[model samples]
Target: MADGGAPTEGRGSVAAAERGATAIADRVVAKIAARAAREALDGVPEGGAPPRATVTVHHDVARVRVSLELDYPSDIGGQCGAVRHRVAERVEALAGMDVPEVAVQVERLHSVHSRRAAQGRIR
Candidate 1:
């Protein structure tokens, strides 16, 4: 009866650790997303805009999910793959967690030509 409390305390400690890990995972996801966005849009005019991204952390054993809304060009599969790899590397390095997957969602496509047309600079 006296030793029963020890197991409860241990379980509580484990729970606390799990919570901490989750928080770390969330932060890692945000950092990776920001980095990936910056790298992907490097040298672009609107690259400085704040990234529109949503990051969700799962259980400690699972991978994190990052959804990004960005204007991309046609044939963006290569760029998307690069972004995923870069982000996963950063997250794994920072959080010491394995990222089994990274899902990239292209919300829109923006081109200089389109921008000029929209701004009335071109027909």
Candidate 2:
């Protein structure tokens, strides 16, 4: 008998199967994805929102979706690819979950010229 009359063969002798598992929360994984996206980008566009992420984890697999704003006149495809790679890598490394899919959604684009024009700074 161990503490509180719990039956135990010996101290620190619990079976691995019975020891249970560590579960990482979905929100935590999402945060990791978002941060990783930010790391991949050269810079967040001025007046643009930062990266945001949401994820669904099931049986050690995580499917992530990231929404972000970018600057105009950039290699949008390359940027999106970098974000996808980084998010998957970080999520798997930090959460120990397999990331099979990372869906990148471009919520908006911020252009300096547009901003300047709209603000009457551009002649």
Candidate 3:
């Protein structure tokens, strides 16, 4: 009866229907997570390029995989942990999705000297 003869079901159904087909795209979540991860890695002295993120969403849950370039001689476990925690928090807060899993893949490692050398800044 509401909105031109569109039958409103029960109260729960009516509320759900009123919400409409709202969906947060996977890419949006992925980008959010990626940004969070990058921010989390900002403290690393030898941080390299931006990470690559792949996210898959099912209903309200999202699975994210991030490929990162980390510096050698760093706390890999701690950095990865920070990335996972930040990504999940950002995805949940920004995208309103439950992040059940965040798989971090270390794509490459670079030492401090090597990093400077790669940028042609060696003395």
Q: Mind giving the per-residue lDDT tens digits that candidate 2 earns over 31-100?
A: 9999999999998898888999999999999999999999987899999999999999999898999999
Best by TM-score: 2
RMSD of each: 7.8, 4.9, 5.2
lDDT for every model?
A: 0.59, 0.93, 0.86
Q: What local lDDT does model 3 show for residue 22?
A: 79
lDDT of 3 by residue, 1-80 (tens): 66776666773356655677878888888889889989989553455678879999998999999999988878999999
**How much is the lDDT of residue 23 in candidate 3?**
87
The number of residue pairs in model 2 that clash at the backbone is: 0
Candidate ordering by lDDT (highest first): 2, 3, 1
| lDDT (tens digit, per residue) of candidate 1 on 24-120 | 6466567666676557654334532444445666653335444444444545777667777877777677666677777776655557666666779
List the candidate 3 regions with Cα displacement exceeding 4 Å.
1-14, 43-47, 116-123
After TM-score superposition, the amount by which residue 121's alpha carbon in candidate 3 deviates from its true location, in angstroms, is 9.3
Clashes of 3: 0
